[model samples]
Target: MLEYVKTILQKVSFNAYLFERELKKGMRYLMPTELEEFKDWCYATFGMSHQPILNRYFRPAY
Candidate 1:
């Protein structure tokens, strides 16, 4: 599951909206430990958790 998320994460940067959707799906499917590791990976990769960042960038602009 983590590997699947990693693979999607790699491609998601190409489209913020897609990233947002996929991320939500990931949250649904990932276990607690997997979510933690995913969070860690997000911090390591982008210097913060991916959730709020993706929301800010990908959500409908007001």
Candidate 2:
């Protein structure tokens, strides 16, 4: 699921709205244990282009 999401995210990276939508959708299907790893990969891969979107979704709960 994580790899599949990564692939989708990469494919949709051209559109911020689509990327964010897919990111949200992808997060839904990930296991709690996979979230940390997924978050790390998202930042590493999309940080330059979509830090705001990633940050919004990956923010720590207060």
TM-score winner among the candidates?
2
Off by over 4 Å in 1: 48-62
TM-score of 1: 0.67
Task: Give candidates' CA RMSD values in order.
Answer: 6.4, 1.2
Clashing pairs in 1: none
Query: Following a full C-alpha superposition, what root-mean-square deviation does model 2 have from the true structure?
Result: 1.2
Error of 2 at 24 (Å): 0.3
Query: Model 2 over residues 1-62: C-alpha lDDT tens digits?
Result: 99999999999999999999999999999999999999999999999999989889988779
Q: Model 2: number of clashes?
A: 0
Any idea what lDDT model 2 has? 0.95
Q: Please, what is the TM-score per model?
A: 0.67, 0.94
lDDT of model 1, residue 54: 52
Instruction: Give per-residue lDDT, candidate 1, residue 6.
Output: 73
Q: Candidate 1, which ten residues in sequence have the lowest lDDT sum?
A: 52-61
